[model samples]
Target: MSRTLPALRVTALAACLLTGAVLTHPALAATRAAAPSPAQQKLDRLADQFYVARAKFDPLLYATANGDSRYDDQIGMAISPVVRAKQFAQYHDQLRQLHMIARAQLPEKARLNYDILEFEINSQLDLEHFPEHLLPLNHFENVPSVLANYASGTGSQPLTTPAQYRAYLSRLNQLPAWIDQAIVNMKEGIRVGVVQPKAIVMKMLPQFQQLRSSTPEASIFYTPIKNLPAQFSAKDKEELTAAYRQAVERIGPALDSLCQFLESDYMAAARASSGYGDLPNGAAWYKARIKNNTNLALTPQQVHELGLKEVARIQRQLAELGPKLGYTGPANQLPQWVAAQDKFKPFHTEQEVLDAYRKIYATVDAKLPNYFSLLPKARLDIQLEPELTRATASDHYTPVAADGSHPGVFWAVVNDPAKYSNVGMTSLLLHEGVPGHHLHAALLKELPLPDFRKFYTEHPSAAAYTEGWALYCETLGREFGFYDDPAPYYGHLNDELLRAVRLVVDTGMHAMGWSREKAVAYAMQVLGYSEARATNQIERYMVWPGQALAYKVGALKILELRAKAQKALGPKFSYPKFHAVVMGDGTLPLPILEAQVDKWIASQK
Candidate 1:
């Protein structure tokens, strides 16, 4: 939060672009001034080169997901000291080059691009101060689990062509090296007293154990072999099959070795304290994370206070809804009664759950055009999360591939239908399906934006913009008439309350020294979450500090901006146009989005 782009750069770039040269004849100049300024031309060239550099710097996993095949053969490990130092140097060099540009001399859009690039480079630099690489893999972000998904042929990494097939094998061959580097980094973290919480480690070891297979066919690495194209030559198929067996043989032992290290050695060293603040200079680190995730200059206490108010307000609303739902008791106990009701937990089979989500998608898909003028062209499909990971997985959306070879996927983790409440199903579909991530992410690909903007996954400040937009989309159900039903309305409120609870508990765990148990207790007591659900939620916040805060903070900002626009424009305010403004620039920091909204409001006048 302390470091920011210089104001001089902003002013200088705009001035140089707008007033650098004066035409002798104003009339002739007006018609002939269609060409961009010299600063814009330079900025355009820099943007092109930046994307090239970004491609080389991207993690191999993200590169594969982005459909950039250039890095398929390279399992780029940034965990090692040598690699991390190089990454730091490269980021610094990019930052230096960005500083050279007269940001103020550029056009509006170009200047915004410059600011985004600067934020990304600076954020990467900021990350180097912490030992994040040491505690790299968690239950939430286990690389092996990700690799298994990809290898199992259900993920984004395409294995259609022979070249793509070989690329997959090459990546599998490099898994051992990635595992080795992670072990080294974990040891370094232990040496320096930075590690994941023991709770996460306990959960993670079982995942690795599940990945270990005795036979090649039984192994996840053998997934591609099962789906080999019939068009391949017999000799090529034989060679690939042998190679895959070898890779599986190698990967199996590596998985066991890594699991052993984590269970026996690293587990002992894992941090008992959940907060990042417990580490060296952790307070400042967590504050930077808050800024990074929220893209706002808010202190933890300020966020905490805001969260408390929101919780109280939502609880009041829940109380108001209770009598309407035939429950006249206290609001806090409403969720318990709702959970116990046979009507809310109506799904008796997994198929019923799938059918319910599909119906929700159909319902929302038909209503989207009423609220949004700009809709995604890409298709979205609903699928059940794989049984292997569904127990831990939440309902999530995977963006469509940049090439459109794959559609956006909305995966519902229907671990047990009898236990899964259908109350939040409508809100979940809206957030994860038609008008939430599927719409926002797929539309970004169709935008006339830079390739870097369209494809990258680990962009510096995207969570709040994207996730907040999804959360905001949840509120749209009311406008579309989905919340007229009491159950769905209660679900919407529960979802909103969940985000509010995140802000309180996320900051509480990281900044205010709340214990894991306290955070879990607060979640269960206030949100009516089950013990296991509360534990998982708290542990997620523990591992990834400040990320949960993005949802509430981002949604609030969007809501606030929409209110301001409606107030300013009054009769001229258009909901569709306002939505277009928010999403027009693709994913942006909330501050940039607010500015865009303000500009749209002025145009309406």
Candidate 2:
């Protein structure tokens, strides 16, 4: 990836050719107006330099994160702690430079440049808090585990050619060292309190063991190698067949070694306490995480309270829908109804499930113009989750590339038809498909932001605002008259209630110090979620604290803003206009999003 331009900087070129702030600025030189100042040119060059660096980083980061290996050569980019530290300093320095230049020199549309700088700085700063390299592999999210899935010729890892096949072998070779370092970091985490919960570690045991069992061809990840490209020369095919066998040899043993260490050593000493607060200074660190993710100053208690209030509000809405369907009693019966409804049961086959979701997409796409004045340029596709990782994955959406080379993918984890609920698909589609994440993320990608702002979004990509908007889209089915069936309508609310339960249970687990049993029990009892589902979710929260809280917190904030916008504008408010205004800004901090809508409303008035 190119980090530098030949001589002419990217920002300078933009300023000179695009802005014409340089040569004869039609007006500037005509009025004898101040020619482009020397400082302006310098700032332009600097901005261009940043863009060039960003352009280089964008595709590489994308390739890697998306599971592509175009930049495998850069895999050791952060290998050394000293180099990592230097990278952190470099990030801070760049952020400082942008802060000064943005506040003083850049134009208004370029505000994203500064915002992205802040995000990058925060990311780099946060990296120093834990020595994650010490523990390169964890059960919850590790390269070995992920690569096993990737090598299955599913997900983002390409396996179309012999070269790509070799790439996988090479990456597999790197796993042992990465996992070794990961164990060390995890040990450090244990020393300092950053370790994963025993429950999550338990789940990983089965997974790594699954990796350990293999005839090379029998392994789940080896499926693609077994089905090598038909066009490959016989020699290449034979060589690839051998490569797969070789991969399983190293990969299988490495996984077994790591699993043994984690199971015998790490899990044995794992914390009895589950919350991030239990770690050393974990309380303060969690608070930082809360701030980082929600972009709100809310205490856990406040967020917890918000969840309770939202639960009540949503249950009431669900009750209204239930009565209309001639199913009455308490409103809370819907999740149970969601589970018990025969019509809502899983499809007999995977294609049935895919078709079901695809129909939802088509239906929603047809009606999108009814509710949205703006639409994303990127397309969305429905695909099964990668074989390597499907068991753990629920449905998820990946954003389309900013350049539109790829379409947004809505991955359905159809590993078990038994657990799939007919009631949940509506909410899943509304949130993960069109008019939800696909729209939100793709639009954010395409927005005319700085190269930095355009691509890099981590946990705090403003989940509440983004995810909240998606949740709100779930409710919009009612607004657009698309919830033609009571089951689908309730399906949407069932998921809403599920999220509400998360508010209670996530806070229950991390902030309130509830044990896994207590958390799972409360979920099953109050929310009607099954024990298995509850166990998985509880373990998930155990591994990644404070993440589940973001969904409800984010959804409520968006709902709250929508109400304010509607009430403030009263008769003048238009749903389409309101949606456009809210979504027009990609992902803003909750308060910043509030200000964004407030400004939009004031202008409308």
Candidate 3:
């Protein structure tokens, strides 16, 4: 998953440059010079209103994540039924307000904005039908894990000043209520047969147990106090430390209580079945997820078939490459053979693993200008995934701070350096770092887009565009000369194949009623993943249904658009220009993206 942050500083020169680019950019600059119509003005007002209103429900997410400090002392009760109901009602109201606007009369940019806002409002309304709040605690994403990241002083939550520290302490004070609410929701889920899978509940137990330290000093929440700025007065430092300790003490029991409930009552009620199809209204729910994530009206059966075809297509490429690497075996067995290679496991230390990624970064960074005309102003940094979440987290990109306090982070999960395979390092960095997420996301922020468009919290509905673009970036390895070697190229294919496999397995589990074991076995067989890797990936899909499908679904659409542009423009085609057309609008749904590309193609002709 990726996050977006506000721009650090818009220098006069930078602003002028942005203005010039927008005016000249083929995809963005409207041909008409007409002033805003009544509908356009109304649309802009509604967009601003929607952005501000949406922030109220999750001020911590909207403010802290975007570098706004106004809500620093607050963590809104998103899990509360009353709060959710209000938000749900707001979604309906927003949709109605959007409908009141005459979209056709609006300018092109305003119309696009209106369409996107409409899409978002409707997506939220569709999701509102499902009781997702009831089953909020999962192994992959839950409140405890999010709070731990903030308390660690390394995440979005800033802990620099006394006020920031107190703000976090205030948030800590509210932890018990949130946990209590989660329990209430989970119990209701149990009553309604919307409980999580037993395996996921078992996985979550350890995460909660990790939060129960004997003393506040030993807890992850104590990190801010330990790292307090030297500029702080002795009194301030001492006072802050005491407060954090007390806050931790209060928080520990809430965690313990939640864990105990999970172990005792929730565990007994957790469903043995894996798929959402097993739950009430689960089939329709899964279909909605498919539409949300893919942004294409694809059926589960359609996505599954697409995955099968992609698997075969990529496997043929892999089989051809395997022979070049002296592995003349079946395509399915190539991954196992590659994994066993000693050369691929050369790193013996964590630093060695990180250094390898950095080396790939340097190599890719130099070639970026050749393929992209629009690059992010924010720098990208590579780091190891934090210890608490490393076990379950995959390599991911964290956005840069809005105030430029933090650079974009590509967290490489190095559980064991010796076991870390170097085969996928280049492709992974491309996807999570430059020319992928960091490049796509940071550039989007720098664009003159609305806050709603640029900084809305990443949702599954937008995954098709975001994840799709990142996945497509992985293929740029060939163009960058990073895949000159057969090893990295094979790794790229494997990664692509992984996404293709996700489409099959995710839909199979959620929509087709495949067992968890069945899905895991299928991934292991097709991807040559170890039992653990396969199980972990399958479990992630189980928790986040339809999310895994976005990568392939989005990537394929972009690829299709690119192919269409290339065919239509012929000799007029440019990689950088094509990329600008795809990314120039920030993140967009597939249909909108295609429309934008078609407009660009015609403009060129």
Candidate with the greatest lDDT versus the true structure: 3
Task: Write one digit per residue (lDDT tens) for candidate 1, span 1-605.
Answer: 01111111111122222221111123323433347787777766766666666565544544555545566566666667777787788778777877888988887667777876776666667667776777778887766787787775555666777777788788788888889888988888889988888988998888889888878799877988999999999998999999989998889878888999998999999888879989878898898898888888789999999999999999998998988788977778998788788877888899999999988888888777666656667778888887667767778877777775567888888878898898899999998887888888776777656665666443546788888999999999998898888889999999999999999998898989898999999999998888998998888888889888999999999999989987898777766667767775677777777777777677678
TM-scores for all candidates: the values are 0.91, 0.84, 0.94
TM-score for candidate 2, please give it. 0.84
Candidate 1 residue 226 Cα shift, in angstroms, is 1.8
Give per-residue CA lDDT, model 2, range 530-600, as digits (tens). Answer: 89877777777776666677777777777888788778877777666666666655566677667767777
230, model 3: CA deviation in Å?
Answer: 1.1
For candidate 3, the per-residue lDDT at 569 reads 83
RMSD of each: 7.0, 7.4, 4.0
Candidate 1 accuracy as lDDT:
0.78
Which pairs clash inside model 1? 10-104, 12-105, 13-102, 13-103, 13-104, 13-105, 13-106, 14-104, 14-105
Query: Candidate 3 local accuracy as lDDT?
Result: 0.82
lDDT of 3 by residue, 1-605 (tens): 01112222332233323321222334233333467788888888888877777666776656566544566677778889999999988888888988999888876778789989998788778788888889878999876687788876666676777877888888888888899999999999999999999999999999999988988899887888889999999999999988889888988889999989999999999999999999999999899889988888889999999999999999999988998888977767999999888888998899998888888888887777677666677778888889999999888877666566566788899999988998898889989998888887676667667877776436567789989999999998988887889999999999999999998999999988899999999998889899999998999999999999999999989999988988898888888777767876778888888888888888889
Candidate 2, 542: how far from true, in Å? 1.2
